[model samples]
Target: MNLFNPSKRVRNLYIKYGENPFVLLSKFIYAAHRQKWSKEEIERVISAAKKGNYIALIRILRSHTHIEE
Candidate 1:
């Protein structure tokens, strides 16, 4: 789950679904699982998604690249 790596699933999903909130949120959830994010972090992303904050969701996903063990 190296965040720096580009995920084929994500790319394929984007190709098929475009940049809709549901797709972005799904990507966030998937990345969060792979990255093993903290409960609070996952909650925050979920909250943003629930609120229809696509930008926030993208930001949160981007931030995942900086997460370290």
Candidate 2:
């Protein structure tokens, strides 16, 4: 399956956050269950994670957004 259609939460996170993991993660750890997540946020996260870099996620955490990861 393509990462865009990921099977797990992490992959979904990767798909949704893109290079800016902070947006979705800022609101939810894994947004698959929640209906609050916007498509823009999901797309951003997904795009960010697909880039295969965690620096953005780290940067987001640096802001103290209460990330569970």
Per-model TM-score versus the true fold:
0.45, 0.31
- The per-residue C-alpha lDDT of model 1 at residue 15 equals 20
Best by TM-score: 1
Q: Write the per-residue lDDT of candidate 2 for residues 1-69, one digit (tens) a residue.
A: 222333223322332334354564544444433645456655655555446457655443233222245
Which clashing pairs does model 1 show? none
Residue 58 in model 2: shift from native, Å? 10
The TM-score that candidate 1 achieves is: 0.45
What residue runs in model 1 are displaced by over 4 Å at the alpha carbon? 1-18, 52-69
Model 2 vs truth, CA RMSD: 11.7
Q: What are the runs in model 2 whose C-alpha is more than 4 Å off?
A: 1-35, 53-69
Who wins the lDDT comparison? 1
lDDT of model 2 at residue 39?
Answer: 67
Q: Tell me model 2's lDDT, rounded to 2 decimals.
A: 0.43
lDDT of each: 0.51, 0.43
lDDT tens per residue, model 1, 1-69 = 222345312222232234776776666667656756566766664674466355555654554434333
Clashes of 2: 14
